[model samples]
Target chain A: GAGVSQSPSNKVTEKGKDVELRCDPISGHTALYWYRQSLGQGLEFLIYFQGNSAPDKSGLPSDRFSAERTGGSVSTLTIQRTQQEDSAVYLCASSFSSHSEEQYFGPGTRLTVT
Target chain B: AQTVTQSQPEMSVQEAETVTLSCTYDTSENNYYLFWYKQPPSRQMILVIRQEAYKQQNATENRFSVNFQKAAKSFSLKISDSQLGDTAMYFCAFMKHNTNDMRFGAGTRLTVKP
Candidate 1:
């Protein structure tokens, strides 16, 4: 694809429900990342995956937040028992390779936990 | 631990004028990367510019340039000949040279008034 793509551009779910956000990175991108952004707030790093392996999961806010990348091309972020605090825009980005290069971002998925 | 900071919460610039957005970061690692990303109303994060810590010369792209002072840990973006299209939230980000974790600072909202 031309750039990173994300599914379910907007999602509204009841509190406590589980939601999954998907990201399809560029054709050859090997580094995938997830981030959360609140209204008028800065982006918070969630997790990073490199080549189907996540070497750093330290940014996951809680046990309910988890992510996995398969084939080093596609990734998914799952939020279990979503809370109102989880209502925000979830972003996905991928770079050609990790090595401090530029990252192309997706049209983030806006998740609203009602 | 690496942390990025953008102290200016908001800034306004007139068309054709110039404005500088301030950013500072703290890190124990000497080799890393710094970046500036812009997010408009459309909600897509776009890379503005990047700088390698080892590079002494500042990075520049058209009207956008960075003043990077490694000793003072300051990386500021100077937007010369500003345009209304430049109005958006600008973020400062840091990434370790060998790691996948890209830490971002609280963004500075830049409004380029016509």
Candidate 2:
């Protein structure tokens, strides 16, 4: 079975430019989440989507950060007007459902805002 | 709000020896799940082990196991006969029973040397 996968493993962009990171969750996974890992820091919750229910957006650090899951399988995290502080590893994870304890994670996309 | 803590920033263990990584979390929810995830230099987050808060017995997977203290809010991971491949950044995570929101602690960097 295929595990979660992400595209553009490394991305370098200008500070003010917008970047979109993609995630392909494991087939049959209905719960998807996005998290940020900064240097010397823990993973910070970003956003989550469960099936077709409304996504949890509370974890978004600011209005510039947003994410969307399309057709309940693929997700994209878009950062608008990125800042140097946004330079970090973007990790995506998915679970069988919201109640599933073990979530499968993908190889993260490292974004560097230059 | 839930929070996970890993006090040890780094640890080293000799190959074939045993090592323990401590983790503590603060949460009001009575039922939840605790997880240990390993992230190597490849940036892929892998689930090492998991424990259900409602279960009294600890969970074990091969040489990896957990010491889950539900009352004390502590969940420690123990690795026996540690191998060089076990060297990685280990993170402790918390997730309430029925939600997609999960929290992670600042990781502990483990080095297994021969």
Candidate 3:
């Protein structure tokens, strides 16, 4: 089976530019998650989507960060006016459901704001 | 909010030996799940092991196992017969039974030297 996959393995953007990271969850996974991993730090939760329910954005650090899951499968995390602090590995994960035992993570998209 | 702590920033173990990575968490919730994930240099996160809070017995998977101390709010991962491939960043994560997100601790970078 194909694992979760992300595009543009590496992206370098200007401080004020906008960047979008895409995630394709496993074929039938209904629970999707987005997290940020700062250098030498733990992963910080970003957003989550479960089936047809509303996405959870409580973990978004600021209004500049937002995400959307369309057709209950693919998700996109969009960062507007990126900052140097936003330079980190953005990881995407998915599971069978919110209650599933484990999450499958992608290779992660490393974004460097220059 | 629940908080997970991995005090050890880094560790190294000889290949074919045993090594343990410690994790402690603080949470008011009784029913939850704990997980250990391995992230290699490629940035792919893989589930190494998991333990359920209600289960009194610990969980083991092949060369990987967990030491779950419910009362102490501790979950440690032990790798037996460590291999060079086992070198990676180990993360401890916690999630309420049906929560929308899992909180991760600052990862512990483990190096297996031959």
Candidate 4:
């Protein structure tokens, strides 16, 4: 079975531009999550969606960061007015459900803001 | 709020030797899950092992095992007979029962030297 997949494996953008990163969770997965990994650091939680309930946006660093999951499967994370500090690897993951402990991760999309 | 901690930033072990990565988390919830994930330069997060809070027995996957001390809020991963392919960043994560929110710790980079 195909694991989670992220599009535009690498993205380079201007500091002030907006960028959208896409994630395709495994088929039938009802839980999706986004995380940011800075160089030489740990994974930072961003946001997550489960079923039809409202997504958990508490981990989002700022208003510039937002995500949306459509049809309970695909998710997109958008960083508006990106800053140099936004440079990092953005990873997406999915589980069988919210109760499932193990999450399958995608080969992240590295975003570089210059 | 809960937080995960990884005390070791970097470590090394000879091939075919054994090494353990320490992880501690602080949480008030009684039910949760602990996980160990490995990420190499390829940037894909792989689930190494997982332990449920309610389980007294440690979780093991072949050469990978965990020392889960629920009372102490500790979850350490032990890799026996380490191989070169085991060289990567190991991340410890926590998720509350039935919740999709997962917290991660600062990773420990393990270098398997021949």
Candidate 5:
């Protein structure tokens, strides 16, 4: 089976520009999550979606970050007015369901705000 | 709020030897899940093992095992007969029951030397 996949492995954009990262979860996976990994830091939780339920956006650092899962499969994380601090690797993961413990992760998209 | 901690930032082990990575989490939830994920330089997060909070016995996969102390809120990963492939950043994560959100700790970089 194909693992989770993300588009635009690397993205470099101006600080004030907006960027959108995409994620394709594994087949049959109903739970998806987004995380940020900064240099010399741990993975920071961003947002999560499960099935048709309302997505959890509490982990989102600021209002500039938003995500949406279309048709309960693919997800897109959009960052508005990106800052230099937003420069980091964006990772996406998926699991069988919200109750499933193990999550498979994608290769991640490295976003560099120049 | 739940928090996961990995006190050791880096560790090194000789090939064919054994090494342990410590992890501790703070959570009030009675039922949850603990996981160990390995992230190589390729930037893919791969699940190594997982332990359910209700389970008394530890979880093991091949040479990878976990010492899960629910009472102490501790989950440690032990790798026996370490191989070069084990050289990567190990992350300890916590997922509360019935939720899609996961909290991760600061990773521990393990270097397997021959």
Candidate 6:
């Protein structure tokens, strides 16, 4: 089966620029999550979505960061006016459901803000 | 808020041998979940094992097993008959029961030498 896939495997952008990372979850997966991994730091939860329910956006760092899942399948994480601190590998994962199911992760999109 | 900790930054194990990785977490929530995820050079995070907080019994996969200590908030992974393919970055994660919020720890880099 095809796994979760992310677009723009590597991206380089200037500071203050906006960037969008896309994620295509597995077929029929109702739960999707986004995380960021900084150098030498742990994976940081960014956002989560389950079906049509309101997303768990508490983990999003600031207003500049936002994510949306359209059609309950593909998702996009947008960072407006990116900063150097926002440089990290953005990982997307999907699970069978939000109820104690294992998550499968994408290869991740490495974002570099210069 | 919950935090997962992986004490060992790096570890080396001989092929076909057994190795154990340590993981500890801090959480005030009584009901949660623990997971071990492996990320290879391709940087695809793969589920290794998972343990439920309410369950006393440890979880096990083919070559992987977990020692879940609820009182101590410890969840360690034991890899038996390690193979060269086992070399990767391992991450420990925690998820609360009511939410899709998942927290991951700084990874442990495992090197399996033949």
TM-score of each: 0.96, 0.97, 0.97, 0.96, 0.96, 0.94
Please list the residue runs of candidate 1 whose C-alpha ends up more than 4 Å from where it truly belongs after superposition.
Answer: none
List model 1 lDDT by residue over A1-114, tens digit each: 899999999999999999999999999988888999999998998888888554578889999999888777789999999999999999999988887889899999999999
- Model 4 root-mean-square deviation: 1.2
In every candidate, how many clashes are there?
A: 0, 0, 0, 0, 0, 0
The Cα error of candidate 1 at residue B36, in Å, is: 0.6
The segments of candidate 2 whose C-alpha lies over 4 angstroms from its true place after superposition are none
- Give the lowest summed-lDDT range of ten residues in model 1 chain B: B97-106
Report the error of model 5 at residue B18, Å: 0.5
Q: A30-112, model 6: which lDDT tens digit per residue? A: 99999999976778888999999999998899999999999999999999999999999999999989976788999999999
Candidate 1 structure quality by residue, lDDT tens digits, B1-114 = 899999999999999999999999999899999999999988899999999999999999999999999999999999999999999999999999987778899899999998
**Across residues A62-108, which tens digit of lDDT does each residue of candidate 2 receive?**
99998988999999999999999999999999988887458899999
- Candidate 4 lDDT over B47-105, as tens digits, reads 99988889999999999999999889999999999999999999999999987778899
By TM-score, the best candidate is 3
Q: Across residues B50-111, which tens digit of lDDT does each residue of candidate 5 receive? A: 99899999999999999999889999999999999999999999989987668899899999
Off by over 4 Å in 4: none
Q: TM for chain B in all models?
A: 0.99, 0.99, 0.98, 0.99, 0.99, 0.98
Check candidate 1 and list the clashing pairs.
Answer: none
Clashing pairs in 4: none
lDDT against true structure, model 1: 0.93
Interface RMSD of each: 1.0, 1.1, 1.1, 1.0, 1.1, 1.3
What is the docking quality class of candidate 1?
high
Docking class for model 5 is: medium
* TM-score attained by model 4: 0.96
